[model samples]
Target: MSEISQAGGTLGAGDRNRSLTYIFGLMLLVGFGSPAAGLVDVPITFFLKNKLHLPAHEVANFRLVAAIPLYVGFLFGFARDRWDILGRKDRGMMMVFASVCAAAYAGFAFVPVSYPMLMAAVALSAVAWSFARAAEQGLASMAGQQLAVTGWMSVIWSMAASVPYLGAYLIGGALSQALEGRTAEQAARTLFLVAAGVMGAMALYSAWKPKFLYSHLKAEAHADRPLQDLARLFRHWPVYPALAVWFLWSFAPGSGTALQFHMQNTLHASDTQWGAWNAIFAAAFIPTYLVYGALCRRFTARTLLFWGTAVGIPQMVPLYFIHSVDQAMWAAAVIGLTGGVASAAYIDLLMRSAPKALQGTIMMTAGSLYWVAIRFGDVLGTRLYEQAGGFGACVIAITVVYALIVPVLLTVPRSLIATREGEVLPLEEPALEVGAQETLHA
Candidate 1:
């Protein structure tokens, strides 16, 4: 273990206690927050496919429209970094957005279900969710750098997100099936009401003041010039490679809506079975995440990065071979297992690349790219699946994209990966020009 981890933190003895509490608090935020943000996905997809009878491309278009807020997620993160809401920083931002999310859900609960109505509600919820996501991700990045535990934070974030998502997929599958008996309006009302309660709980959790977490945010320097900070962020080179890694990794031409449609229409898988496949895939990741948390402490990011990429490049290959629903379930597990280490390392690298006091901005910027890649990938994937060499073309494209990440990884600053545990990036301004003597502060 590094001295920083052994000593707990740079501050003092109290830093240990603060670090523990802060990490636990983040775990809670990400864990509950995942499903609260995503529980509507399966139902919405099903509603469009089964009820509205939309085509594959139309469904992808709907997802594209609904996810607009997520594509611009950095703006919300910039807002969080520069503006403290009601003087409570991330906590206030989370509470306020979570409440807005709940209200949106509540309003949708009573409204009649139509394609337009569903699109509007989902978009509105996504906007509210953008703010909450920024708050938590920013806080997690800050904690990871401050506590010198980027790898462990990666595990917490990945596992928390995966576990809740597993349950949400199963629950959402059952809920979608249950909605079949009701009128469209009644079904909308039922689903939205449940969504409202989830966001309400998230709001309540945000309202609780953890002194350690609150104090950490309070102690950090607030950005005085938002424009200058944004400019500085753009000039930062390490961020480019980090963001590229996320974009390329998430830009899966073989997955998202394409995979879903293939499993359902081509393989004749029922909604419940689709959900089970997702649950099984998520479950398969738990062990790898656990192992990664340990391995990250022992290995450098470079070591993990190379090995992860080697394993992760073939992630979509299994999907290309699956012809049956049963085979698809096995393929999902294989995909998840193959990608776990790379996914965690991707997150760890992004966290490490964040400039001091700009964790929110960088993390959220990366998030924005992630959603953009995913949505656009869906748009493109659907086309390729229909027009090109079927699903295999998408798989080949995804593999190619994953391979491109290796070249990009070479561009990351050496300073960022010099330590096993996270060594905080410089607090001082990074040198702007390439070949500058001080690319990173010592």
Candidate 2:
């Protein structure tokens, strides 16, 4: 008995050491991917739209197309679960995917002429991003035993990712100003190339240190699960309202992506000015997350959700009165803070509602639905912006929708918080089972 106790202590210490190492490694991987993504998203959305001279509706349509591959990527988790693409090496898979993503970005940067080609590049980039994202998240879940820690780690990584956007805003703005005489296309392409180079370097780092920051897991030891199983898993009574809240929250801000262009053309803001304003918007979220983490300890997730939804009321309401670029920028910054808090609270709520084994799938599904809502909202909002004859009316319409979310948020009950500690309750299985049984019965 004494000998067994001693051996168990030794193994336990080893596991702790290994888990800590994995955590740090995951942080680095997140840092690389997050910033690269941020750099690309801002330029593609704001700069590309302006450069292409695409209408808001057309831009929204293309965005919808770009997002399709992301959903497809979610399905890849099943393959990832079954196969050892990089010989069961998570870091190797991450590098391979990141490389592909970099190449796709380069294609977008250098390939000239034809909107079809641009769309193709966008699709490829989305695929690569999906591959890395699925693998990275799966690894994060495995590394941290505590869901709260995993959530906190994600928050930290996101904060790091926000750094590149700040830099990109500053640099992209300066370049746009210096190249004032250049066509919008030329400036946009140049910025894309710069982002590509940054991503390419990170890809190489991931390849060279393939084992550097990865959790040590024997691929063969883990059981495989089907990705399609997620749809069934979401049918639980609790999941329904939780997901509704997620979709509504996502749809609200998705209109903001289109609003960036409105800031430029409608408000007549310079690229440099827009960039500065975006920087403010992006930076405001960091502190809010800190507050959220602190508040989570003292309050219920439901309370946080309620307050988050209520706070958002002010965000959309103020946008109706904005006249100048400065006002628009400040409003965006305020929205960012509100959005940051709301997002943190929502994610916390989601984690509580989902089981451990299904965390990635549930989160991805929720994300997919959120993006879908955004895509839907964007299409409608763009048309409304055009039909209503100005940004003010659009703001009012979205604000009304935001107000409606309060009651929707209230629909979530306190009983569904079982997954808060990452516990996978038997009751939650009914959601997934019902979906499966329905399909089977059908």
Q: Pairing residues by index, what is the TM-score of model 2? A: 0.76
CA displacement after TM-score superposition, residue 228 of candidate 1 (Å): 1.3
- Across 2-81, the per-residue lDDT of candidate 1 in tens digits comes to 33532222343365446555555545544443322367777888889999999889999998888888888889888877
Per-residue accuracy of model 2 over 1-442 as CA lDDT, tens digit each: 0111111122233444444455445444433333223454555555446566777788788877777866544365433433445553445556677777777767677666356765676677677766666556555543332323333443543455455556567665666567667765575477556656655665565454323222222222223345345544545456667677777776653355457667777788877887887677768777877676566555655676778778866666667777898797778678778766676766655545554345455555665676677777888777777777666666776777677778877677666542322232223432222111112211
Measured by C-alpha RMSD in angstroms, how accurate is candidate 1?
5.3
lDDT of each: 0.77, 0.57
Off by over 4 Å in 2: 1-37, 45-51, 71-73, 77-83, 87-92, 107-109, 141-147, 150-154, 157-170, 177-193, 201-238, 411-442
**Cα shift from native, residue 345, model 2 (Å):** 1.1
Worst 10 residues of 2 by lDDT: 1-10
After superposition, which runs of candidate 1 have C-alpha atoms over 4 Å from their true positions? 1-37, 212-218, 422-442
